[model samples]
Target: MAWTVPGLLAVVLVAALLTAMARGYALRRQLLDQPGERRSHAVATPRGGGIAIVVSQLLAYIGVGVLFPQAAATLAIFSAGLVMVAGIGWWDDHRPLPALPRLGVHVLAGLLLGALVWHWTGEASSAGFSVLLAIALINVWNFMDGIDGLAATQALLASVAYALLLPAPVAGLALILAAGVLGFLPFNFPKARIFMGDVGSGALGYLLAGLVALGLGTRSAPWTILLVPLAAFLVDAGLTLAGRVFRGERWMEAHTQHLYQRWVKSGCSHVMVTSGYALFGVAGIVLMHVFTWLPSPWSHLAALAWAAAAAGLWSVLLNKVHR
Candidate 1:
């Protein structure tokens, strides 16, 4: 497949238009948006914008994969993983489902999609590592969803950035995903008109895990592509959970201890906070590849240690932010 700027642009445009239209419809319908304390923004914004993102990305992947059968199997697994996100996220959006039930869906979805992905691409060995990676990313995306447009914005930046970095199948699909979220950002940014809700955030999270896995395991571009840019989310989620455990608090329940959440609570602008995270994430990726020539082991222990330390430090650091 020839890499062309026009082709990528075309995919992005399609995604943006699709997401914008879906968000517009949600606005017109006055869907479920009950904003109050605990939310990033004060205004009531339309929700469920993730539905459009899921649809646009799925369609784009299918269209591309059909044209390039060699990539079809890999993409089919991606598309299936997305369906899991949509099915379960949409259900949660309509009515908050039990935590265990919702988690069961995520777990099953991750495992099933993981199996398909592993089988289709001979990623079986990678799957052993990817199962935990996939689940961690899904939670990272979910936990980072607290701020207005933060999760969606991160998805958009990471997708496009990584696409530019690795332009084959990963970049192609990422182009579409980025476009879809970019189209929705205007409505979801600092002063949001609509939110991505669980639909967009969850699906984006799942898709990201797939992209990173493909990029790292197959492309071997750099480990940083999968880690640093996402450090903000990973650190926050990992650290928050660690802190909770240390403090004898439940890890899964809703809370405002996330670094991003703490920043917002301290009277910082949401855009400023979100942008800070994005920059830090991009920095992490850059640093990863600065020495890309070095052969390295894919150390899960090291990754966890980094995440745990970062989270722990951030949890403590946040205490001094507004206090």
Candidate 2:
């Protein structure tokens, strides 16, 4: 990687520039998300800005493929899956699509990712897990994208953490994503000028899942440690979704039932809630790195402990916060 520094810089610049362009297009086209009961923001805002991140990431992949021709097949597969996820999301952002159809596309993309990982690692279990993880994250990030800075910051932290934990190629991919998210964060945080929309959120989740799969494939670190960075978002999104489904509600529909949403409804600012999640993300990243130094059973056990603690916190938050 002689192109490492240049790739990162290019991604950041492209992401920022594309986000601005997307925002302008959204505004001109009147593609805005207006405040309502289901939404967290108070004002109508331009969306579809996440297309910037998607485009930037695709470019990064192409760049990598061009530089390292040996990785071209893997990158092509990865890029196809990404386009599938991002394409459906991009459509939904423009003209809302039904949940099942979007989900079908996600499943298809998941299978593609599963195959890619299977090819990389020659492991059936990793392939299976990759499928599940891709589907799970594609929706989780969308679910957690309700508040300002929350989704983007979590992505930034998770990608950077993966970059540190994984080996080359995959590690480089993760860093490029982190740089892209870093460029997109300012427009969305403190005061959101534009939203990532479905396009950005779902694509991000897909990319994160892709990175996790690559890490597993490369055997860069223990599988358990690779998952530690995503604990907070997963716990929040998973438990909230589980609770919804258990109650026989239309779980696919958007609502403000997440703990982060409840905290905001309970009078916390977006910055406060977002920053709090960032701290959890930072803590998880540190813990994962720490676990890398520990032995097998201990590292795995420690990761499980972190997840358990997150689940406990989820329970506690639900008890303390009133809708």
Candidate 3:
């Protein structure tokens, strides 16, 4: 189950091939995302290419579980939740579903994922929190997937960070997920050949939530570590939702109000915006790691300082975008 260089390379190659094939299939099936007022891209592009990432990561998990029988139950639970989310997303992708029904499916999948975390950590109270976190992450990730390559790039960076922070089995899963996203990136970055669709975005959010839970269950680090790398997405989405409610707008309706969206609207290319977010993610990872090496009080102070800095940066970025 140890991820050797050869194993990583193999996973990446397989995922890339699968993604390319999925792109072709998507084009043939006319699964395209069309240009719109809320959309960032101009031309129609094939979507649902994220299926490749989902399949690749799931297969890697199964392989790892088989090789290490002790981890099979946990892996099975994770896989089951992933399948549920991905299935619902795929269904939504092909045929539009009511918001309530899609939300319900997301809640169910979140509960399943929460239960998996509870089983691992033996903390029933944390399950509720985990469920809420999972649901929120799924929706937030979906909201941020408006631009080409942004979600995939963020997922890749977060996955790699998790792999570095977690222990063996969980780290192995994170590594595979990182590879899977990397495989999908070539088709998505700069110019899009295909989109990840709802299927990929929702499932990725679920996967990251699961990883965060696993990290909490196994590691002794401050819980803030879990939130650090995700601060960028959380802040942008959270603030936008709050602002919408304040303005009496339909917060749930699709719009180009997110910081990243605004940046794109400000004339930055998709690649430029995505790279900026990736850098933010890296800063978070570095800060989280540095905090771990500090004394308890110092670590708390550092976390607060980072939070303030992030808020200030967000404010500055928002000001740059003409509403």
Candidate 4:
């Protein structure tokens, strides 16, 4: 525990260094994402800077495996799944891949993570939830990552929230995740040096699912509390997807239809939208701590209430900005 701050700093440094290197690699390889009508950014930028975060987190997993040999097998399984998700994403970033094959790899990775959840808690329900969480988060993150700072910043805040709720080992892992994102944030936020790419965003979702699975397995807190930190993104991404589907649109097609994207298009700066979402995240953290102290049914009720409030706010904002 005493070494946590130092360890976090070390990982942050490693992630920053790795991100810088990833940027160079992308530029050298001419892996550029051009600005487009369906896109958010205004200029061409090197993608896949997320490889740095993936590499940094994988190294952290290795260190954990070495320190706790008993946990190595499970960590190995988790790492394998992580590789699948990141691997597909990395490949896609270099050469565009069809959605079905990419979804297939994501499903496989989700199953692997689901098995880890089952192994941890022996609960089929929890395992099922992990699978869905993995798949949902992977794509949700990818969809929401349209703007500078939104995806990574949300992840950093959520990881910090989970770290506070989980036990020591997993908590430390969460902190390390937050630190790695922190390291990447400087290069991303306020201005874009390099995008997180599919590699980073998908892997990030899987990594968060891993944390949620561990938290559920350990009974660190109520499952509802675990959902709090993710409320904002789920609301935006879920509603946007549903809207597209209801309108008989190609739901999976890349588009700037998300609430955050609309906000950006409505003349609000990326900083404003990101900061607004962050306020909700900070509120979620505060609510998580409050939910911890409440009785069981009440805590669950409060989480639902907060989520409803979030959805309501999202609707109001969406209508306002759509005008």
Candidate 5:
């Protein structure tokens, strides 16, 4: 609950150990992700390393709730939602499930999280918007998990931003989440020894959404301020989805058409692409904080302008690469 440095380090170490164990388990169980035309990696790698992150973060959340009973209900909602999302993702990782079933579970998790936000803020409108945002983040994170390290790294950046911008308990939660992902990153980045799989990615999306909702409910910052840190992911996933629909492509089909994917296909290494996106995330966070000083309406405009600039830069990179 205190989020002392030693306590956080301990959690990170435990997460790393758990992640290492999960990697062994995945190898023994043959839960490997094989390379494909759409995949970024060349060799088969163990998957589901995200289970460690999920487990560690959940444990931390429970610990926090126990220490701060006032937060118990909020943590309970988060834990429940995480279980539902991670459960379906775990199942899908080992045995592919129908899209409808997965989507249904996602919707359920969104509603639960939305309810949690509404409970805290006592605003029906906020709850409705949070529900929609949660679902979209879940799907977008899942869609962007095609490459090694991209999703996890993005989650790390966003969590760090949240930790910096938010207040006590929420900031502590964000830090714990960041450490968990940090522990998992070594097994995933540069060249993935294990993938986060759907389990990790989906849970992370939900977790980040929950953090944003918590910040908004507490008035730590405006909704747009919280959203700014996620611009890289939102822009890429949004633009790619729109492009797919416009081209009449099967939007749900696996493909390497994402900006990061395109960068890889154009001969950039996964590290380069991921780092580029990380910089985008960092920039967005910086801009969000800066805009907090402006008048309310201007702050909103500033956020939108920053996002548009990011989108335009991405478009230029995509075009240059393709050409």
Candidate 6:
């Protein structure tokens, strides 16, 4: 898809309309939320704006698919799978869904995404790994949903940067999504006029997992290297959650224990921390591109080291901010 000026204009216009309507709908529906003891924002804000991301992606899929029917079913399955997660998440936002049911929905969506990717790719070695990766990614993304603009920012970066790292079908679908998140972030960042709610974050997590698996299917990029766009979030969330479980905390409960959350609590502004994360993502993706030409499997190790360093740095900065 060589994007001409008209194509770019179409994306921006569609995205802006989607964002404006989402903001209006969330506010009108009294879907706004307040800053809680566990929340990073200090003001009441509309929270269901992630619906705009869902809407934009669907429209783009239809527009793109009609031009390229080969991708129609693939986009359909991708949208259908992600929408289930978004639907459950939106319902929970309006009505507090019980924990068990939500988890069940997540599992079902994850399973469906895995099944569709496997069916489409017909790749054998990827089956179990896709399911496992999908679960890990969904949870990591959920965990990363701590600060304003963080999750959406990362999604935009992955979608944009994947152009070099991923193949066509996976890349096109992901870019469509990336554009939506990019359009949404302005309303989500800094002072936080609106939030992604669970609807945006959970669905985003599920979609990213599916796309990443699809991107790496036949590509020879080391598993660890490919994960670089998000390794910091994974490490922080995985370790923190596991530590809480070991300490007898109710792991199912939502709390602001994530390192970024703590950093904000320690007194960093949301802009500073979120900006740091965006820059870190850019660096990681750049590194991945730089190392792809290398011969050794150890290039992945460099990324892993960088990820660990980032996690440690953020933890230290957070504690210092706390003090």
Please tell me which predicted candidate would have the highest TM-score against the true structure.
Answer: 4
Residue 119, candidate 6: Cα error in Å is: 2.6
The sequence of per-residue lDDT tens digits that candidate 1 reaches over residues 172-242 is 76676777676667767767766777777778888887777766555556454356556667777776788
Show pairs that collide, candidate 2: none
Q: Candidate 2 at residue 151, lDDT?
A: 94
Clashes of each: 3, 0, 0, 0, 0, 0
lDDT (Cα) of model 6? 0.76
Task: Summing lDDT over every window of 10 consecutive residues in candidate 4, give the lowest-scoring window.
Answer: 1-10
Tens digits of per-residue lDDT, candidate 5, 183-247, equal: 99988887888899889999999999988987888888778777998999899999999999999
Specify the poorest-scoring 10-residue window by lDDT in model 2. Answer: 314-323
Cα lDDT tens digits, model 6, 88-204, are: 888987888888888887877777777765785686556666767776776677678777888888888876766568866557666777777877877887656778877888878
lDDT tens digits by residue: candidate 2, 1-323: 66788779999999999999999999999999999999899999999989999999888888888888998888898889999999999999989998889999999999999998888889999999999999999999999999998999999999999998887656898998999998899899989999999999999999999889978988877778888999999999889988999999998888999999999989899999999999999999999989989988998999999999999988897788863
What's the TM for model 4? 0.98
Q: Of the pair 3 and 5, which is ahead by TM-score?
A: 5
lDDT of 6 at 303: 70
* lDDT for residue 242 in candidate 6, whole number 0-100: 81
Q: What is the lDDT of candidate 4?
A: 0.92
lDDT: which is higher, 1 or 6? Answer: 6
Q: Write the per-residue lDDT of candidate 4 for residues 67-118, one digit (tens) a residue.
A: 8899889989999999999999999999999999999999999999999888
| Native-referenced Cα lDDT, model 2 | 0.92
Show model 4 residue runs off by greater than 4 Å: none
Off by over 4 Å in 6: 2-5, 120-125, 218-220
lDDT scores in order: 0.70, 0.92, 0.86, 0.92, 0.88, 0.76
